[model samples]
Target: MQVQFGVLGPVVAWDGAGDAIALKGPRHRAVLARLIIARRRVVPVFRLVEDLWTDPPADAVGAVRTFVAALRRALEPERPPRAPARLLLTEGPGYALRAEPGAVDAWRFEQAVAATATLPPKEVFARLEEALGWWRGPAYAEFADQPWVRAERSRLAELRLHAVERQAEARLGLGLAAEAVPDLDAHVAEHPWREDAWRLLALALYRTGRQGDALAVLRRARTLLVEQLGVDPGPGLRGLEADILGHAAHLAPAPGPGGAAGRVWAQTAAAYDRTVPSGARVRLESTVGLLRNLAVTGGSGLQAARRHRVAAVAAAEELGDAELTARVIGVYDVPAIWTRVDDPEQAAQVVAAAERTLTALPPGGHEAARARLLATIALESRGPLPQARRAGRTPSARGPQAARQAEEIARRLDDAALLAFALNAVFMQTFHRAGLAPRRDEIGVELVALSARHGLATSEVLGHLIRLQARSALADFPGADHHATAADRLAERHELPLVGVFTQWYAALRTAATGPAAAAEAEAAYRNAAARLDGAGMPGLEHGLLPLALLCLRVQHAQPAQAEEHTDWGPYEPWARPLALLAQDRRSEAAAALRKVPDPPHDLLFEALWCLTAQAAIAVGDRQTMERAYIQLTPAAAELAGAGSGLLTLGPVSKHLSDLATALRRPR
Candidate 1:
């Protein structure tokens, strides 16, 4: 006999004739929902009573047993007297509900979702809709607040989200991108933290020709990441933005509503696969191409890269050439830095593995490439641009040297992409490991020229970003603002989502550096920048943004929602945590907290950090702490002595250390 049970929403049951069973009221419904949540496993009567009732009666166990009897009567109303209940079984100390696979809506929903896994595009779309149909409103809406039910609902919601993501992919794959937009929009609204959903949404927008809205969503996501999480955007999202900016051939749509042709990139993959000659060389080349496409194509970069890395290794082994394999490995090396599962502290393990793998490699392309790979890992581990730059001057710093090799090889091979990558390496070096960004105006100009010639939007945006920071540190106000404006404009115009958000942030930092007169304006701008930081991957926004950050602190008006963003700053928590307390009018506590924030070694933000401590201490009547902070400022006094006004716009690198030093040490 067919019995359809749906506990995913309200509890509903019907036998083969589709007639609703006369299940009693709320208690009966609660019993059914709770049992379904337990997935037919034996749930003890005492536990069920605790979870189902906020205030349990003295006879709770007997009450639950009565509810189970009502449930059994409802499940099989016509069962003969003394006939063992088929659906509800009384096990030791508890009861269980057992139904066929398709009987329960929640089980059917999962089954439908699992069925979509290996289906073709058309089938996937149909199955996804079927799975989505089970959600009548949150799973078990009546029991939404029940602690036991909450976990199940959360799991189902997450499952539903995954289903939505997959459904959107199917829609996009079939060239039905516009159809997926509504669901993705809702998905992101409900769950802003899932960057992949944002990525897919942005892509759908781009594919449907809504460039500005696409940029806005990316910016919005950035803001959430920054103001709410104090972090930068993920690489997959960044890569998507870059591709959008450059109008990457791969992202361009295949004509039609059904997406029967899929994305242009898919066509390229097929074409490339066909071009390779059948041999070990073919295998090696195909793997390399797949790695690049996966890395650049947005979404699933790491998983695809890992899979192909092994394939490349197998082909290299078959060909009997270690150098060839090392070169292949080199091509795929940067993925570790950008992988979705990346752990900043875990790079040393990867470095050790790479070193062992390449130790026997001859002094050729492989050795240099491995060194460059290590450099990327080192930079990635430090977290963000400035800190990474400062951290790179260690005894183990080899990225710069290896990058030089890549530059030479690219020049020899006349490869534009590799040359661009190598130029980026040079640019990375200009952040000046000493703490402040040193003068690198020449490299900025060169980057501008290189990136423009090759149509590299990411490079162009970065080039301008570098110029903007350098100009600010040099106290070139008009020039700094000009660079800032240019970067901000380009970031908006191009698909440089991260760069766009960063320009907005750094531009505000520049404004804040203009001093007291600009604080209010800069404060507003800083808030705007925070909103756009999700895609701004490089980090170090805190330094230049400090002036306005202080304004927010001083006024005791900083928003907790925004302050929550920096909670994961780890060791740098003190640098930002006091601002949170200050926002809540906890002055004395903030002052106490500031005293504990130590100056990191080789710290570029050293002067600014101390000055902030001094300012914060003054607010809370901590004269001794203020004096100690001012004393710490003395070391950088001479460096900024000759510098003009507005060093606050200067970053944590050597470039602006003098400006910050000069200003902090000025007579009271």
Candidate 2:
């Protein structure tokens, strides 16, 4: 009997006939997944209790044992009654699943990565392809939303990414860099922060006799390291760069950190006082340089950026150098989030001051650079209020055309910095001009490369946020959460103030859609986020806030106070007139008022509005209103049936729609 058990993506068992055997249920599937990841290592019962349940049941031990027993039966239906389990055995301390190496897909992938040393280049590539093919989705994709499962899946996903990185290296190693050039180029483009991959791409270029191209890669990498990280390239990379410059004959491919420790850490680490000559006394020039260096290092966060800006201001005042002043301000005036330090008004003031200063500067390259900086600042500091967004028809909103134009301009300029700036600029515009930017998710990947390659800290934060927004907009909640996690981590590590509000909004939406106490928490989060949204001054807040208020009302998370007789939804007053009617206890009028709403934008809010309308109409026994509303709402209703909160009501929303269809048909 040939059976394959895979935990590479979904936990599944398949027979030799190429059909998947069903594996189901929350707890049961989790138990099997844990065993597969455990990889025959004994997992203690105590560990299982904590991993499986946040608040373990009083009979948690009994439940875990029950789940394991069920899994054993599902795995081996022919096992003799009362016989000791052979495959899943209860060992001295705990339980273990004994399976051959090839049976588990994760183990196979690990093996392929490990066995590359013994295999030829083509063979290594083939094995990696085979290993990668086994993944049906994200590792333990079905269980990823579960906190316990998330940690393990993230670990596996990283391992999978490394495998891809290694496979690309193999392609370069096999003298196939010409064939590998396009892929390696794109790979490095998407993950430009990865110095090892950059090194590989450079080696590929040199091996292909494109020595000049190889030098260009190293120079850009070196510049990015100095500009973004405030550190020089590591010794191996520097040595390789030098050798490439000299057209060294022995320029062999050197792997990144995967090869050695020397490939990773910068060798420019000086012990102490070496530069100061044993405390002869530090000077103002050196101090200012350190402050300037602090501006570029990625992980130092918002305070570091501010410190550089302030110090540079003082230096300019003392020295009376206009160009130096502009350069410092230009570098640090990047768009970022703040907790409370710089609110909307203060940010507006900063923008005004910067504009005034720019007018005083002599027009030249400095002016152009200052203008670009001003554009970035305005993007963060001034745009539209939260309510300015509407998914209205627009012939000009097609995103790819604008992005391609910017891309072409950047390329024609032959400037990496300009290209990085263009990518981010185009990325921000996608949200503002919305025809539901197709493949918006891919933008995050390019931004990731751009930020890393050029050391753009704002792009790093925006890249993650873009993915978060794209994932949520698509209703891929699990993927959204993944991006949210990365965004939060980067925000904290980098001290990004602007990222907090955007991440908060995403988190609230996800929680509102699915949390156990969805209404109460989501309402609070959305209200706080609404204030921040107003502060952001980005377009779409008008459309964005309407949904939140409607959701809050629909969930009964926070009902409108009786004192509020009218809802001033700004330009959307006509479309939102029903909320005011409902708040005033005019349920009949509320149902009638909704007739003014135009065709919905075909987004989550579309479902929210119609569901609320159907509820209001039902209260008034307006069968005609219900029938008309349900016709437009049916498809969205069916898709969102299981989703809780006001987006689609929890109980039988689909059933309710069906029943209404039946009632409408039966009546005169």
Candidate 3:
């Protein structure tokens, strides 16, 4: 018979035979409760005695044994005839109760709460509803006065409140706001001091087109706060009031036939459209505000619209009006996306919206003046040719007439900081694309020249440029050492994460250039960077760059198993798997896998370099193929030749390339 015990609420013990198993007395109940909660585990006799009697007589152990015997008899009245004594077993200084997980109401409650985490609103609501339904009255009502029971009861009460909140939130999300209102209203009435409940009620009211009522709710909350605690409502509640007041005409709650939550959601969407871009500072402030607000509130309408609103507001602010603020805000958005939202599609959409807004802004008004804004937006967009063209456009220029616009902007922006920013953005976009290494190098030289002229030696812009140079070296480009050394110096001097990334890149390149032993120090540096920065919420730079460097080390070590464990199969999977396969001596399979990798145009140069190197290493006997591979890498090599102090791997990679050249020249 399946029996469930829920004395934690009302004493309810029912079996499949439809008979109530009498659970009587506080001590007897405590014995059963302790045994059930610690089911299949031993509760030492001394521990049980200690729990039952905070200050016990000398015969505490003997008294505990008597209670246990009494509990055994009560649990199995007809056991003497034939039933085994398997329900409770004696263990070393303890007792164990044999029962399934659902046998205890507390266990069931925990299970329900855990199950609701990944489920949709309807499902979560159902589970929580079932769990909450089991509560007939105050938990352990008979023993509420007891210390142990009081603590347990308080814990259950808190869990119940949490479940109720989750259930209300789910109902709101599922467009059942009206149905949730009554329960939520009762909850608010029960605990009038609970701000979250009040907030939920206001949200529901607003959604139902009860804008006046919603405002009234806030006013009531304000009054309640003053009356109860002698303080005004907090920022979140006040902000809701401000939103309603500021956009009253637009927020008139729809008359209810459907759910009020849905209406509220639609209203919020409309509000987002209206208030997002008042000005640069306002937009930035609003975007940052919304992101933070949603994190704390955890409701539907306003929170749901937060990402889109933030993106739109950011976009509107970047329209050549407030360049520095917009750029700073734009950079801040990258980390915010990952930390704030679980939905990748929604996060990506926010970024895309910001990029589109940035792109639509008028260009060439004062490239030098707007250099920071232009550079930040260009980098965020991740497309060099388009950004370069946009940078060139002026009110008077048309067609090829504005071809020199980028250079003009760079020249006019004589500020070293601004020019360096633009160049780094350009370099990032170029290097990210497959075949653009040569172009990246060419542009990089120009940036270096600009840096030299303007004395922009210590900044994030220089860090970015140096990191790119290190990447080129890893791809076996010439003169990578210069960039690597510069990046190292800058990183050491400034103590920045970007420098740490460059250091790893340099270490990896040095390893690849020299031998496995040369890479040990580099590997240690990469590990340190990964530990320090991977999840630390740093923005704009590649957080995964350290992981890539680690993978490079795995290739050097030929540890396929370790590589498989650490490497993620997303962006770097294509390169990672092939590298792993080559390491494992699966040459043909590695080459075949490399062929399937997407050939994004900009990524071609680095891709070709790595692919050719891997192919040559695997097909050591094939001189002709090695020669062909070497020829494909020449353009990238030449591009790296002029690279300066920023290149870290040039020395090691150059050596590897020389060895490959020597191998190719030998008789086949």
- Models 1 onward score TM values of 0.50, 0.36, 0.45
Give the per-residue lDDT digits (tens) of candidate 3, residues 406-475: 3347667555655555555554444432234456556656666666666655443354344455445335
Clashes of each: 22, 10, 28
- Please name the candidate that would achieve the greatest TM-score relative to the true structure: 1
State the lDDT of candidate 2 residue by residue for 87-171, as single tens digits. 7889976789887788778787777778876886668887887787788888887787776667778888878778777887777
Candidate 1, residues 343-458: lDDT per residue as tens digits? 33243433333444566576655435554444443333333233333446442255455556656766676666555566555554432232233444565677678888988666
Best-to-worst lDDT order: 1, 2, 3
What's model 3's lDDT at 213? 76
Looking at model 2, the pairs that clash are: 301-494, 337-497, 337-498, 338-497, 338-498, 386-541, 386-542, 387-541, 387-542, 389-540
Model 3: ten consecutive residues of lowest lDDT: 332-341
